[model samples]
Target: MTKPISGFSKLTKEEKIDWVTANFTQNAAQSKKILQTYWNQNDSVQQLHDEFIENTITNLYVPQGIAPNFLINETLYAIPMAIEESSVIAAASKAAKFWLKRGGFKAKILGTEKVGQVHFIFKGDAKKLESFFTYLKPVLLAESASLTKSMEKRGGGITDIVLKNKTDELANYFQLHATFETKDAMGANFINSCLEQFATTLKKEATRYDAFSRQEKDVEIVMSILSNYVPNCTVRAEVSCPVEDLKLSAELTPQQTAEKIIQAIKIAQIEPYRAVTHNKGIMNGIDAVVLATGNDFRAVEAGVHAYACRNGRYSSLTHAQIENGIFKFWIELPLALGTVGGLTNLHPLVKLNLEMLQRPSAQELMQIVAVAGLAQNFAAVSSLVTTGIQKGHMKMHLLNILNQLGANENEKATLTEYFKTNPVTHHGVEIQLSSIRK
Candidate 1:
């Protein structure tokens, strides 16, 4: 059994790897070799990756792909996606191309307000706390002025600060709810710094307030942090065309396809079991772009899912309908993204991906990411309603299956052609490969 080791982080990279592999891995030599195999060749790059987190071992790489012909708001783009999934990029590309001639995607920023809070326990009269807050708000803002200076200069800063009395929910619980406009940066660090300052100011000012009693002056701060649930920081992306032009597959008529798509979304809206998987397909596109552009996909995931459940029930993020003679599909969801901070300036591929995206601002990135999600959802629903998702998905997955089976060049080429007409399945592919090998 492995024993806990203190000061493991203080060890050299090689020593750390040796210690972990020897204790934890059954084949330490093979494990060590596998870990070393992924290390960057350049010392400088390796050093940079090492400093990104504690106890770094080796880099886990995801494939970066491009989905071209994305026409958003009359502008053309080839969005970059970083993902390990098989058919995500292909599906996104297919959707983008399908919409390209039909007046591509149109996206607009709905809002850009981010939120943070300072939670605290105030055992005081409600009226007294309210009066004390009125006096303390300006001081909280003033003390955080230096921190907001640069952000303000960029046309972004603290928008508002309000005190909420939540004693009804939990005894003496209250929050200093604040909102901000962060411009081109994600502003996590900036928001956090200001929140921490507010907490300090609240504790100090309460003690000095003339309206506060001795017991009320002892405002116990629980925590100060930024929220990932940014409902107001949202964007909407959509594509519409005449219902007659909604030809997605040969088997279904344009009208049939459009109606089926609407029915599918309606099912997702009422059914949580389907809604979770439905929204996950949408995130497949959103997360890939967010990851490619060095934005926080995990944060985006949490916020989007929370927004899905905003109506007291989980529902689909994307919606579709047929109005008059037109077919329309769209998605509106919260996506807090930044193009100017965090790993954007650090990771080489992130920088390249941003440049490939024409260096979009935070709002622009939100619209782009939203469109990616809508496009992905459309592709998935279109597949589900027509030729079936497995047909195209499994076809795209053919190469991955073949590679995993260790099919060489000639074998891969032969099986690739064979599966073109036949269904692709793990067992089916294995049988075919074995038969060919014999």
Candidate 2:
């Protein structure tokens, strides 16, 4: 059994790695060597990575790929994606190319409201609490002025604060629900700072209110935090063309292809099991761009799923239809993205990716991200209704399978070309490689 070590964080990086490998790993020397091998060659870059987190081990690298020919809002862009999954970039690029000749994608921001909350417990009269909140609302905003000043100067700040009563759900539960306009930054830190101040102010002012009894005055603050469920911070991306021009494959007529795509989306809409995987396919494109741009993909994921289930049933994020003679497909996503803060300013690759995007504003980035998702869904559903998803996915996964079997470069090249015509499967690839070697 391994014993817990004291002051682990205080140890030097080498000492930490040494202790970790010696205690936990079967082959400490090999583990240490592998860890060191992944470290950046440039001292400065390696040091920067080390400081990104505590008890630093080694950087875990994900491949950064570019999905080109994404035409959003009449502007062509090569969107950068950082993900480990195979076929995501390929699927997104294929979708983008398919839409390029059909006049590209149209995107626009629907809203940009983010939310924060200060939850508290108040064991007092409901009427008195409401009266006190009416008076305390201005104080909450006033006390957080210094924190919001800079954001306000940038034309982004606290929009409104409302008092919500939740006693029916949980005893003595109330919240100060505040909304904000964060402009080009995600503004999580800013919103959280202001919320903390509001919590402080609420507690302080409650003690002085003449209408409140002693028990009411003793308001207990639970927590103050920014919400990741930003339904209002939304963007819409869409592509449409005449039904006759919707020739996705030579196997199906334009009308049949359009109907199949719509039917696939409809299935996702009603079926939760299908919707989860369907949305995941869309997120493959969305998260790749979100990670490459240095935003919080986890937060985006949470908010988007919450939005999907907002109507009480989880459903598809992408919708398709044939309106008259036109075939239309689109997605509206809740994306709270930033172009100016967090990793956007710190990570070298993030900065480069933003520049490659022509330095899009938060709204523009939202539109771009939404388009990526819509494109991905279109590609996935189109493939599903025609050639089947595995046909293309397995083909893209063939290289990983080959490399895993330790095939040489020439073998890999030949096998890749062979799989272009032949079906790609692990067992088949192994047999083919073995025959070639023989």
Candidate 3:
């Protein structure tokens, strides 16, 4: 049973914590201690973390790790990953190392165009609307010059604008579809600024258009924003080697292993349920790099998932094929990333992560992220075909179980060695932990 309190947001930080603990926590003092324990000791750094978002209590920490030996496009890299999931880093590293001797990964940028839209309703003649749009196009672009000037100077700016009539979808529904080339940056802010300006200009011009009646001229702007579904902002990463080159282990012959891997991927490609999880594995790699480099993982995830279902079926993002004694695995994803804006220059760890990768441009980062995803999928599917995904996943999950059961260092060491040969399960670990404590 909880009671509501007014002015919760306006309370002082200490007062807010007190109210939360008093109303919710069984042990208020311990709860307070736990929250404060995670705060940075450095005052300035703590302050910086607090301002990152609203209603900050304490920092929620995710392990920042590196998956080394990622050889992409004739260059070697150690990719930074920030995630809470067990086995993700280990799996990525294993995959990277496995491919290091097999010519590594090759990645290329397919496109860098981003999209934005200005939606409005025009209860007017279609012919008149078209005529008005023709005259308004250059004016809209010209009005946005101040906003796009800096981006244009950096070799990135608005690429094209087109008026789309969607009146059939909904009466008077229309959109000003715009495309952009945002080099070395995610360009959300730039695109959005330009779009708002377009919206304003459209409204102002419609008010003065000589050909429009009063009702027709009153164009109601629904919204102006950049779209996260950036199908045109895409990259591809692939790994190919001779069928005989996949000498991963002696348990399965290379040809058999290749067949199994391809079949596993094929099942995912045709099945929606499996494809969702399969694509999730790919995102585990992509998102880690995106977050480490101070880019928007949410935007990347949404766009990538949308792209996965672009063929009318939600299939696997990673594809596989075998032809002429050659085996190939690849993935193409729409990753809208940035290296010069947002958190790249703000957060300390983000700066370090970017510097560790030798300061890649947006395109370079895209290639790197795509390679990470491809490697991750290869490792996951390879394991699934051979030893089963759970074996390695459970092993990586052992530490988390141990921490949860409050195992001491000595107990953890013994259990760690024992589980190397035995399967790790929550119940099994708990029983062993209880026996050890007794």
Candidate 4:
């Protein structure tokens, strides 16, 4: 049995699956959906069409397991995530269990506002394009000033909007940076709505032009896309653990473990090339939750990479430190995520996760996400510093094999002994299982 810690409940291996199956709510709700909007069986756009001859996308219903032991922003939260990776759920829960000996994760956010961009493409003529935007900017702003949604009225709206010119190999293009204020939403749908409205107005004004009449003078829209350069909202989480508790399972001095883990992370952060894989490990935790909740995982993925290289120095999404024998950690990913929009509220698994977390506010969910990231990092680092990651994970792999082989209790014991003694082989397992059945 695992040692007990405050604000956390320890589960045996069996209970973990039960918990996931419960809160992920596989039994209570219908998970499978053949919809045009979301596709999981078919992972991406190219794969869906060329490979699979299916028009409808498959909405995946992966398990949303709660990572126990987190207290962020004065609220205790059991983070619920959906991911299929072997170690992520286990590693995060292990770290949370250890951290429970302390006060758990404390976190804060800068604000809940987000920013989006809309690109406007013009013709190849440089001087002609310049003259068009010069006239269009005033028309674009003045005509759409009152068009500001509830966001602008409620102390936050399109505070800053600007246009930029680009000369790429394809053609000359202009982009409208619509820096809008999204109070709590990640603002993808809302911003896109505003962009559609603004774009329609701009195109309408262009039709009545008494200006440049050449065929190339028209605002040829290459792509009026929404930009992922998020607003100034930053999320931070801090978790501390008792040294005495960590010393039990890990067998290393708490300070030594912390130092070793932090050093490995520093290496991952310092190098740009290594930082790619490093941040991937972080996203192993983030993407799971985002996917589970039916939020835009792609946007979160974009924001993370964008945030990593923001300062020209490539760094890990999370930072860890040992201060006064306390393991302090913080992650500042651009969690430009929304709770109210997209499939977040539609999917059953996501709804269950949200309910299990006690239905936190938008900002609170971001903090919880950061906490999961912190726990996941700590989990991975602790194992790497002490016993190496494969030690626990490999055992789980063996158990999975056993389940796949359909070994009964007595046969499982016999197979375990055989596995421990003999060289491993998939063919051998099939033959042996066949013989046992016969």
Q: Listing every candidate in turn, what is its Cα RMSD in Å to the true structure after a full C-alpha superposition?
A: 0.8, 0.9, 1.4, 12.6
lDDT of 1 by residue, 234-318 (tens): 9999999999987778898998999999999999999999999999999999999999999999999999999999999999999
Error of 1 at 223 (Å): 0.2
The 10 consecutive residues of candidate 3 with the worst lDDT sum are: 7-16
- What would the TM-scores of all predictions be? 0.99, 0.99, 0.97, 0.73
> How many Å off is the CA of 172 in candidate 2?
0.8
Lowest lDDT sum, 10 consecutive residues, model 2, at: 241-250
lDDT of each candidate versus the true structure: 0.94, 0.94, 0.92, 0.67
Q: Residue pairs in steric clash, candidate 3? A: none
lDDT of 2 by residue, 1-438 (tens): 999899999999999999999999999999999999999999998998898788999999999999999988889999999999999999999999989998999999999999999999999898998888889888888889999999999999999999899999999999999999999999999999999999999999999999888898999999999999999999999999999987768899999999999999999999999999999999999999999999999999999999999999999999988998999999997999999988899888899999999999999999999999999899899999988998999999999999999999999999999999998889999999999999
Better of 2 and 3 by TM-score: 2
Query: Residues 1-438, candidate 3, lDDT per residue (tens digit)?
Result: 788888877777778888888889999999999989999999998888887887778898989999999999889999999999999999999999988988889999999999999999998898999999999999998999999999989999999999999988898899999999999989999999999999999999999999999998899999999999999999999999999977766799999999989999999999999999998998898888888899999999999999999999999998888999999999988989999988887799899999999999999999999998998899899998898989999999999999998998999999999999999899999999988889
Higher-scoring candidate on lDDT, 1 or 2: 1
Model 2, residue 388: what's the lDDT? Answer: 90
Candidate 4 residue 319 C-alpha distance from true site, Å: 1.6
Give residue 252's lDDT in candidate 3 (0 to 100). 92
Error of 1 at 344 (Å): 0.9
Clash-forming residue pairs, model 1? none
